[model samples]
Structures are given as structure tokens and as C-alpha cells.
Target chain A: MSKEEKRLEILTAAMRIMHQEGFEGFKMEDIAKEAGVGKGTIYEYFESKNDLFLEMLRFSTEQFITGLENSLATGTDLESKISNLSLFGSKFLSSHLNLVNSNISHLSLPEDSKDQIKRYWEHIYKTIESELAKAIEGGEIKPHIDLKMAASVIIGSLNQYAFKKLYGTGLPPEQIDHQAIARMILQGMQK
Target chain B: MSKEEKRLEILTAAMRIMHQEGFEGFKMEDIAKEAGVGKGTIYEYFESKNDLFLEMLRFSTEQFITGLENSLATGTDLESKISNLSLFGSKFLSSHLNLVNSNISHLSLPEDSKDQIKRYWEHIYKTIESELAKAIEGGEIKPHIDLKMAASVIIGSLNQYAFKKLYGTGLPPEQIDHQAIARMILQGMQK
Candidate 1:
């Protein structure tokens, strides 16, 4: 594999260990084994375990942003856009939210991570806010509906429903009816 | 004050310590000082520091369940019910969610705590599910909408919107347009 691909492989492996074992439980050797890399090779990708932990946060955030942008891009209108986002949210949250939240709240993280988390939230919030604005311009929904509230509704619905599914015995992410949710959200916001 | 009132006061005090200082950071004397009670008085209510800690979880969860029930009780119909719930959630989650989640995930918590959390979730889920079921029976919404999905949407929306307010620069909970959010959610679910 290419160097970049291999680097990502190690990161993913590190995330797995962290996800399963938390911040202090795993070792470098554990990550190396999980990644199918030699011990020394793991060192080449991340300077230290702390580095790998921080990178995991960055990697997860970056992955989410990319997924979020892509999710919003494919739809021509609000309903389809929300549907795609719902699907992405359901899939992405169950797999990665635990990793993200755990790392963000762990004491070992620096103050910078809190700012990163805040900025990450703001970035997603703004991205969705603009998407909603565009939808309003397109006459997909009511003109005067509070855009910030609308954005919160959309983001919140995805987060809570995904969390519910994760915590409760319910449909897997793939089986969730995203279109229904999207339709429900849009139907409410429409004039 | 009455005995029950004093007991609750102590629990609230313990929660403050736990909330500000985390699981390990506070002492019994600190809690007593926070509560304006003798340190010996704390032991009269709780067996030990661990007991106080565990009670904080139970106390917080019980408080949430009570608030949730009362919030739903004031509304005679679906729209009013959802609006009331939204207001309560936006206010309560900002204060209690971090504590509940931190305690639920803390290493010192026993496996039994996991069961309690699950039961707590299921209780709220069923409570809201039944409330929605009543709404459908009353013809406030469509008969054929997926009730489980509907329930998830409501719960998820409240959770997420509240979280957004907690993390972002936005309206304080009291100022949030809970009615708007309620309308949006119900509008989508209605026939």
C-alpha cells in the first residue's frame, strides 16, 4: 500500500484499540498488532502514543467533515439532502461518536482539544446552516423559519436518533428509515 | 427543614461536588460545606463516599425522570406536550447530562449501574412512546406513522437541540423557541 494509506491503516488500528480499551489501556505493541504492522513501523507513522491519540481525534473529525460535506452534496433539494445526511449520520455516529466523545472528554487531552471540538461543532453547524439557507432560497421550506433552530433540529434529530439506536435495541444504521425522517423534518419546516 | 428535604439537599450538594470536581476530586467535608451541613450529617444519609457518589447517579436520573414526567403532564395535547418536553429538556440536559454520562461511564461504577441507565432510558422511551400513542389515538397525527421512529425523532430532537445550546453560542434554554421546535416536529408527524 502507499505510505498515506499505510499511515491511515495505523491510525484506524489505534482508534480501534482506543475505542475498545480507552485512553490508558492500550499499548504501542497492541496498536502494532492491531494494525498488522511491525512495532518499528508504527513509530514511523506516529511519534508517540499521545501523538496517535491526538491524530485519532483529528482523523475522526476530518472523516466526519468529509462525510458530512459529501452527504449534503448529492441531493438537489432539501428532502433528498436531509435524507442523505440522515443516512450518513446514522452510519457514522454508531461507528465513531464513541471514539470522538471519549477522546474529547478524556483528561489526558489538552485544552486545545476542547477548542478543536468547539470549532468542529461550529463548522458542522455553519455548514448545515448555509445548506438550510440555500434550501430556503430554493423555496424548499418556509422563508421565515428560524434557520439556527432548523439547523439544530436537523443535527439534533440525527444525533439523538443515532444515539437511541446505539443504546437501545433497534434497527441497525442501514435499516433505519432515513427518508421518513428527512421527510418528517422537511414537512415540519415547509410553509 | 423536613428530613426528606434535608436528604435531597445533601444529594444535591453531593451532585455539585461531583459535577465540579469529577468522581475523585471531592471530599465529604467539601460536600458538607457545600450543603451547609456538618460532615457527620452526610454519613447519616449515605453510608460512605462511594454511597454518596452512587446516589448522585440515582439522584440525577430520578430528578430527570420526575422532570420529564411533570413536563409531559402539563400539556393536554401532542403539540403542547412536545413543547413542554422541549423546554424541560433544554433546561435539564445542560445541567445533568454531563454528570449522568460521566458517572455511567466511570470505572468505579458497577455493572448494576449499567442496568439502571438502561432501565432509565427504557422508562423514558416507553413513557414518550405511550404519549405519542395517545396522540395518535386522539387523531393529533396520522395513524400510520411509525411510532418508534416518531418517538426517536422527538427524543432525538430534544436531546440534540439542547446539546447544541449547551455547546454553542446561542439562546439560553429559557429563550429557545421550544414552541417552534415542537411545531416543526409535530408538523412532520401530523397527517
Candidate 2:
């Protein structure tokens, strides 16, 4: 595989290890084994466990962003865009349930990792902000809407459901109706 | 003071110490000083620092619930209810920004403390859930609404703004327009 593909492979393996072992029990040797690569090969790509975990988080975020962007690109109407985003968010959150739980409850993460995670979330918010701006410019959503607050509301609402499921307070991920949620958000944003 | 009043006073002091010193720097002696009680007197009420902190959290949550219940009782219309809730939420979140920040980032909290915190949040969610139910039953909100998800959406949206302000990513608390946010939530929930 190309260098980029190999890096992606390593990150995927790291995420699996993180899911199975959690942060406390995570081991680099396990990651290497999961990646089907030698220990030295894993080290060549990542300096340490922290480095690998951080990169894994970044990689996962990028993948979500890419999926969202693709969905946004295909939808011509505001409703479609919102629906696509919500659906993608639900599926993504469900698949990354362990990561989301760890991110919420794991307190031992280093400061740098925490900052990186915060920045990644900020980037996600910005992406949604731009989408809202486009909707407003197209007269799809109300022009009077507070873009930042609106974005936060959309993301927070969607995330609340994901968090509930992860915390075992809500229905299983398969039972959540993403389309219904998208409709509520769209209704809230309408002029 | 009556025993309950004294407990409230002590909890208020604990909250103040938590706000100013954060969880790590928090000291029982400081709380005692702030509460204007002797160290031994503090032990009379709370068994330990952890117990005091947990009770303080529970007390704060009860206070919030009381405030919300009073407002919900007074509001005649759906709009009034939503407005009152959003306004109260904004002010409460602003004042407790430090507490929220610590709760989100502090990982060293004992498991029982964490469980207590989680239960506090669950209590808050249930309060909102009941309000949503009342709104629906009174024909204030849509009958078809998913009460639990809707409540989560409202709380999560409000919290997102608070989180952003705490993180310095959004407007200061005083500058946020709670009415606008309330309007958005009300609009979304309306039939």
C-alpha cells in the first residue's frame, strides 16, 4: 500500500484497539497485531501510543467530514441537506459509540489530546455553520437565524441522542429515528 | 438557622469554593471558612469532602428544578414557558460556567461521584421531560412530538451555547440572546 493508505490502515487498527481495550488497557503491541504489521512498522508511522491515538481521532473526524461533505454536495434542497447530515451523524455516532463514551468519560487524556479533540469538534461546527449560511443565503432557512447558535443547536441536539444511547439512557442506535430529528431541526430553522 | 437552612448555606459555600478554586484546589477547610462554620461543624453535616460535594451538586440541581417548576407554574402560554426556561437556563449556565467546565473535563472524580453527577443530570433531563409532557398535554406543543428527544434537544442546545462560551468559542454569556434561542426551540416544537 501507499504511505497514505498504510497510515490509514494503522489508524483504523488503533481505533479498534481503543474500542476493545479502552484507554487504560490499550497497548501498542495489540495495535500492531490488529494492523497486521510488525511493531517497528507501527512505530515508523506513529511516535508513541498517544501519537497514534490522536491521529486515529483525527482520521475518524476527517472520515466523518468527508462523508458529510459528500452528502451535502449531492443534496440540492435545504431539507435534503439537513436530512443527509442528520442521517450521517446518527450512523457515524452509532458506529463510534465506544469512542464517544471514552471521549465523554475518560478524564486521563493528556491536555494536548483534549485540545486536539476540541479543535476537531470546532471544525465540525464550522462546517455546519457554513451549511447554515448557505441555507440562509438560498432563502431556505430564516435570515434572522443566529448561525452560530443554530449550528450549536443542531449539533448539540443530534449529539444528545447519541450520548443518551451511549450512556444507555435512550433506545439503541438502531431504534433512533434520524429523519424525525432532522425534521424537527428543519422546522425550528424555518422562517 | 434551621438544619435545612444551614445545609443550604453550607452547600452554597461549597459551590463558591468549587467555583473559585476548582475541584483540584478545593479544600474542606476553605469551604468551612466560606460557610462561616467551624471544621467540626462541617463534619456534623457532611461525613467527608466527597459527601459535601455530592450533596452540594444535588442541592444545586434541586434549586434549578425549583426555579424551573415555579416558572412553569406561572407561565400561561407555551411561549411564556419556553421564554422563561431559556432565560433561566442562560443565566444559570452563565453563573455556573466554572462548574460546568470542571464537570466536563475533570476525570479524577471517584466513580461514585461520577455516578452522582450522572444521576443529577438524569434528574434534570426528567424535569425537562415532564415539562414537555405538560406542554403536549395542554396543546402547547405538537402531540406527535417525542417528548424525551425534544427535551434533550432543548437542554443540549442551551448547553452547547454554554459550552462554547466556557471554551471561549462563542459570545460571552451576557451577550447571548436567550429569547432568540427560545423562539427557535418553541418554533421547532410547535405543531
lDDT per residue for candidate 2 within B78-136, as digits (tens), equals 56765677667667765542343222313345677767777766766787778777777
- Give me the runs in candidate 2 sitting further than 4 Å from their true place: A1-3, A36-41, A97-122, A165-174, A189-191, B1-122, B168-170, B189-191
lDDT of 1 by residue, B1-191 (tens): 99999999999887777556653457898899999999999999889877777788777877877888998899987888888988887777655535543223423346786677778877877888888777777877877776666777787677667666656665688877788788878775223
Question: Model 1, stretches more than 4 Å misplaced?
Answer: A1-10, A22-54, A97-111, A189-191, B1-11, B22-54, B97-111, B188-191
Please give, for residues A1-191, the per-residue lDDT of candidate 2 as tens digits. 99989988988888777655554446778888999999889888888876776677677777877877876787877667766776676677655523432223123356787787777767777888888888877777778677777877776777766566545354565567776777787685223
As for candidate 2, its clashing pairs are none
DockQ of candidate 1 is 0.32
Q: What's the distance in Å from true for residue B64, model 2?
A: 6.9
Residue A186 accuracy (lDDT) in model 2:
69
Q: For model 1, what is the error of residue B99's alpha carbon versus the real structure, in angstroms, after optimal superposition?
A: 4.1
What's the lDDT for residue A51 in model 2?
78
The TM-score of predicted model 2 comes to 0.68
Q: All models, DockQ values?
A: 0.32, 0.25
Which candidate number maximizes TM-score? Answer: 1
Query: Which ten-residue region of model 1 chain B has the weakest summed lDDT?
Result: B100-109
**Residue A23 of candidate 1: its Cα lDDT?**
39
Q: Which CAPRI level is candidate 1?
A: acceptable
